[model samples]
Target: MRNFALLAAGALSLAAVATVAQGVEDPYIWLEEIEGTRALDQVKAWNKSTEELLAQDPKLASYQSRARAILDDEQQIATPDRIMGDLVANLWRDAKNPRGIWRVSPLAAYRAGKPAWRTIIDVDALGKSEKQSWVWHGADCLAPAYTRCLVSLSPGGTDADVVREFDLSSGKFVDGGFVVPESKNTAAWVDADTLLLVGDFGPDSLTASGYGRIAKLWKRGTPLSAATTVLEGTKTDVSVSPFARQDGDRRWTFLTRGKTFWTSDVSLLTKDGKVVKTPLPEDASFEDIIDGRLIAKLQSPLTVGGTTLPEGAIVAYGLADIEAGRSVAPELVMAPTKTQAIEEVAASENILWVKALDDVSGKLFALRRSDDGRWTQAATALPDNSTVRLLETAGKSDTAFAIVEGMLTPPTLYAVTASGTPAKVQSLPAKFDAATMTVEQKFATSKDGTRIPYFLVRKKGVSGAVPSLIHAYGGFRAAQTPGYLTGQPYRAGPLGMFWVEEGNAYVLANIRGGGEYGPEWHKSVLRENRQKSFDDLHAVAEDLIRTGVSAKGKIGISGRSNGGVLVGAALTQRPDLYSAVISGSPLHDMKRYSKLLAGASWVGEYGDPDVAGDWAFMSKYSPYQQLKPGVKYPAVFFYSSTKDDRVHPGHARKMAARLNEYGNRFYFHEYLEGGHSVGADHAEDAHRAALLMAYLKRELGGKK
Candidate 1:
């Protein structure tokens, strides 16, 4: 927005959601009309005005050029996406291919840096041929042979995408193959002829959150209507998605319904032609099945067969035991510590890979199960301050690819196997010179005396306070860690490259509501406690000021989506601390947030505003509702994409309009397309980045 992996009432129509004000007098409600002519006209005007302000800077073109070059650098590694034996596939995007291309290359040739890549699908070429702006969502293929594949393409980058069957070997879409029309859906291949699907079947098919609640088994050569319902969930549920796990010749299919954002109901379609539900806690997450054992992560303390596993513990259960209707007895795999939390867990046929955050630094380890079924871990020698993650696992193979990189280091792809140490396969070329830059881990005490960690990146040999920018996401249990700012136009890392290169400091805060420390770190900031996340951001800014790292009024905050709320709250609550705010695809107008696109699904995180109790706490800090007259707020820039079906652009639009009504000054911009990322192509991204650079420079007094 995989932040594509990234969600109102009962499937509310756009028109109905836009019109319902929930008893609040919203004069700017007209902006909620997503595609309404008047609303779009106003958006155009605001975009123009923001452009005019940023264009006043003489170096706007230069800034944009630098940003575009870094984003489109051809020297960047063609990261392996799906690995199948000797053949590897990836989505490649560069100057020539803006939309990207799904291509395959031989493993040996690829490792040698000269691979014969077969273009399975040239997205830019296909878009030109079809006269449509098709953004490549992804491609899922059958394992082993990997000839047949399902390709998803989004129109203008919406969450809803068209799924079509393609021939991976032939590099062509099958003429009489399967196709699902544009809708938010989940699909998995049970076999070549059978697919388990959860998508918009029709009017009553989708849940209240606009995701499919009904799961069906679709057979080849039959109408989608002919598919039989395999499972179903309530409309109030977040959604039901299909997941398939394969080991050797055995494959198990399951449907997981999100009872809430934090809970799930896992139903397995057994080989005996029976559907069985696994009795797991509402706060537990099923990681995957490995070697006939069920792997799960606990978010809270759970008593399983008289053994209570602490929160953030990784445990295993016998698949046969779970399916046999026996009391769920499990084996403890990994326990939690105050400073350690399991960030990722994935398994190949033979080895289990786990990536954990120890004091905000990434550590990788491999696990092996003994004959007695007890698992032991072997810690890897990967350096600290880096984000290590598994990229892809080959079918029935003991090998997988892992990416390792940090704030100042370029991302390198490594091939990990059960036998030996990880070997580097490819490394991304350095985008910016880091000789002058330095990275440091720092702590800030929040309002409740809770210790918060953040990464501070800046030029070395600095004596006095400097202008600083802080980027953070304090929601959704998504752990924010150190990584290079080198993907999408907004490869937002805890630390930024261009800003640090300019001698201005960059801060990446690991505030509450993130999975940095564990489930409790995120759970501590949910619903009524949401304001604490905002307070954590303020604490970081104050800490910087107190430490003489950044002076008062020399600080700035930037966040997109959930991060948007953080900066927005800071503007209204602690405006005097920061000098500028950039809120992108943010959530404001807390009262109407539930009715907006995909807003209802997030009620578990933000709480239901329609409820009087929820609104009591929300209204106190809702930036839009808290906007007052004659308050000296800092320089603010709000951006959102009209085509972003996930987070409604109205959040940014209505907030800016309210500020304008109060005669408060702010910068607002809206892109007609570009989906959740805000811009589609390099030009659009460069333009936006240029504006951001100019705005930050002017407002923060950075000599750029």
Candidate 2:
């Protein structure tokens, strides 16, 4: 088993391990030495070569400047977070404030072009004062009275972060307040003097998947070590999280025991630290509590009290029934169709809002319960073919916010209510000229007869063999939705200005293993059926060529993270499909992925390789293991961060080394920091994006 072998070889030495359980020799394992002197030297050499190659592009300066300008644009929307004191909170980053500022304004003030903002914390200033990187991870405050909150800050943008209690009114960390040292952990407020803590408790306190195994109730004015453990999970379980929910006059504490990525167990915690197991479906996701009802989203079919509810439905049970251990019927709030999926479910005091997707487009609906115990719903008047997101919801009021945007439509913010017309509150100025371009939705038939949907953006009348780029992320139930350059730090304006306006086209594929069609769609391509995603992507490229949207040798593809692995498979399995590929923050060596940082946590998504059956399928398609000597692959560009603790930079490193050994044309770049994303700040992101755009233009012959 690669998992056991990797652990035996030490978590950091996948490259040094001579043989896995199968006795298979891995020659490039030395590249897995992330910080070894030899590995660092190799990374430096690769970075030099990549910089030289990209520096030769004549448009590099222009590309970088344009990207920087757009990233620093001031007309962007200030996304709202309805926090304590009825204020709208926004974390803003621009050229003037690269590290960003956490600021808040009144709802009406935030809607103006120049809001009167009061800065709570300046990350750059904090980093200077504290003499640390101090990247903001976010803050969770006491609900209803959100003045006192726990602030989570990472040293350098890693998953782990240190938590500290801060007072919003004073803009200062509370003296002698709660503070937890850096580790993968979480803390939620239970009351003014009590907190639900889940974090490292020294030896044998963490799961094999690298998450806290125990839930402890910590009281104020006491050492963290003295906290009492209320719930404990096994080392093999995925994770255990603790939280407290309030509904009207009742407050309930619970623990979510994650048995795997797809299954979980729920337990109620008593005031005396007793754990009470609750009977519920293993795949049901606890959404929220409102009106003394516990709402859950079902990932699998559930039958309760003579009524069977289908998968992908929202159901609710009375909190009293759950706590009383009595069998009760659940009220079905909503159900999804084959082409429709529930994107989000939230509650605002008395109203329940559901964000649903129909054929990859977004719609908003409001649901209400009648006295007869039936639910009535109505769709919002949001425009079609756009992405609608629930921005903020009030727990004690009837106020909510939703933002709607599309490929060509600029983002518009709306103030939504349970039974009134949605009012437009704000809108973002268009960053690029999209009047001449058109958006089209098309489908490509995959090898198994599945209709794969994809979005195409191109200039009017442009056709047949134009420089094109197709992108998709087909894992993790993360649906690829239609969006404009909204509050996102990375704007699509650069793509439209530097590519589409210059006679290039872009495509977004909605393939299997994503939640566009909900859980069933994602489950269809798990583990052994992973190739279905590759097939779906390949089919889209083929359709582009067949339908005159693109031509052979004129297309380019790009993806990061999981999508990077998809691009690697496409480059290795079908080299002639594209002219170039950008594999950023990729996972190419599947045999040893579980051994790397955060890789073990994802075994539930990708089955454990220690099992022979799982490895058989994984090894067959692993890009690093499948590279051939004379396959004539296209010139691939591999980019990543040396400090990426999630995927491990070793994946891209070893893959590039193997490609070099096979004498294939390729380029590589590795930055020393920035974690999995390969960028620490807006400036770093702009530069990396510029390099990608330049590489695409050079390889695909786009306008300079």
Candidate 3:
């Protein structure tokens, strides 16, 4: 069909170019090249197919039109600000307000200007003992109306006691603390007066155990009540849906552990201690239980709307037979054959929302269950050159709040109804007008003959060569879509810091290492081909310098997590290109990263060190192991969280230690709390943002 023809034409074009170049070997010779012309053409073809596919779909076209109209209408409301960073998880309107929507960041709680956020409570201020070293660890609000907020604070000093219930509205600590002794606690609110706490029960298990269960449900307001075990296991992944009200005399909670995805044994826990275990059809993964009786599951080799999903084969299921105790054979919900994987799931009463992607862009879709019990497909169209993230859902209105942005557009919060047009809720205030902003698309030829796509964002009418901070995350299947950053203090606020933004930040899209182009894209750059990612980034940076967007000594680079690996790779490969580098919670030491919490889950993305085949490929780019002595890298800033259970702090710590020992200039800071994000709460997020902005200002030659 058209896709095959396009690929053939692209190959022919590559062959022609190779013939003209004389130095090239074959059409595929340029596949390893970063930003080579062939690569750019391939990406363009992929994007073209996506656009054609969307255009052909009526559902997608309608949604796109509606989304575009909303953006066009909201453009006049507020001048978009630069979004410096965002809170990973924060408090926002659980439901839409009759007046207007409200979103409150815990970090923004301490901002000088905000006053609508009246001090519901301050746990540290009313503390009985520890002052200088106290950290808020866990927080959650009760359902229906989240009027009551509960927080837990642990003293940093010798005291291992964790204060469980500190009520925000009451402005006092609840009496008779639920102490976990020396164990860290992860709690979930079950009801108004109940909580599910997960931690270790014994001392030796607390100190040396890799996995801890001790899952117990405890009543909050009750005085030191005995804990009830809902389930017990060494390895357990628990997720609970908010209490649902079904037909008279029935309340249901869904629970799952091992073999839920592959084996599909999900238990429906009733208030009366009745556990109804439902098994799904073979090869189906139980996604979520919709409403009460309808269970959503995914089956393999699934096709939806005539598109084959790329990652693996999958079909969706909605089990209606409750008495059968097993999911009915699944029907095809959506099978986008080109997509590498689909991870996150969000749902409303009538629809199941899924975020998907091919090798070029991230796409979202919703499957609506009709009155006939059949599912109808709807493609959720977001703006071009931007990415959309679903925030929260409201039951009554069936509306969702989402954060939307693109390379040129500033991030804005929007209210999206199920079938109607989206409404703009709030936007970050722009310090500079959009008229003053200019973006240009450029291409760079990589080590091979491949052409890579890149973008440049700078202030209009600002002449001469400018100092620029170049950012990229050229790993994984994640694409760097264009979006707006409003209130980005470091990039825009202080002036003089002319930032050059690029979508090529994620350059592994088609080079066989990212899902953006599909499994083929990822497979191309896996193992020995990993160097293609580094080379792609280098080509972009070099193109910036060659094009006079930035000078060599005046340019800086940054990324976080896996992107941190990009920073290290760039420093090792092209130390002369950047003036400074900033990496946050980086996975610099790839060899030992698999042993960390959740790190083992990513071995499919990052190769396993234990495997001889992988080590040969990984050793070449592994930042921690590849550090060379007497080689001065760019001034680097490394950040890590001591409580970051995901990527171990050892990666950052070892990188800093080796860099410092070798007399390389670097700064390292490890925050004690904040988990892997290093911003457990809103206040901490704002502080982190301010610190990052300050660091960027100092490093990028902005006024301090």
Which candidate achieves the best lDDT against the true structure? Answer: 1
lDDT of 3 by residue, 1-704 (tens): 32332342444444545564886432233322323565445434433442343233333333333323322332322211111012112322111211111123332221212213333333344343444444444445444344444455554421123535554445555566444444454555556666665555554322122333444667755543377767654332221212222221223444443321123245555555445655444334455445544444343443446854323333444333543455454455555553334534555556666665533344556667666756676656565444566655444445555566654566666655677346666665553356656765566787876656555667766665566666566556555544454322222221112133211121111222444543345455655777877787777777767876666776667667877887888888778887777788788877766665556545656667889988888888889778888886776766656666666666765575456445565555556555665643333333344344444544555432
lDDT of residue 515 for candidate 1: 96
For each candidate, the alpha-carbon lDDT, in order, equals 0.81, 0.79, 0.50
Model 2 Cα displacement at 376 (Å)? Answer: 1.2
**By TM-score, is 1 or 3 better?**
1
Winning candidate number (TM-score): 1
Q: Of models 1 and 2, which has the larger lDDT?
A: 1
Better of 1 and 3 by lDDT: 1
Supply every candidate's count of residue pairs whose N, Cα or C atoms clash at under 3 angstroms: 1, 1, 53
lDDT of 1 by residue, 216-303 (tens): 9999999999999978899888899998877667777888989888888887787664678876676788887788877889899888
List, residue by residue over 601-665, the lDDT tens digit for candidate 2: 77777788888989999887888888887787777778888778788889998887666655565
Every model's TM-score: 0.94, 0.93, 0.64
Q: Relative to the unseen true structure, what is the Cα RMSD of model 2? A: 5.0
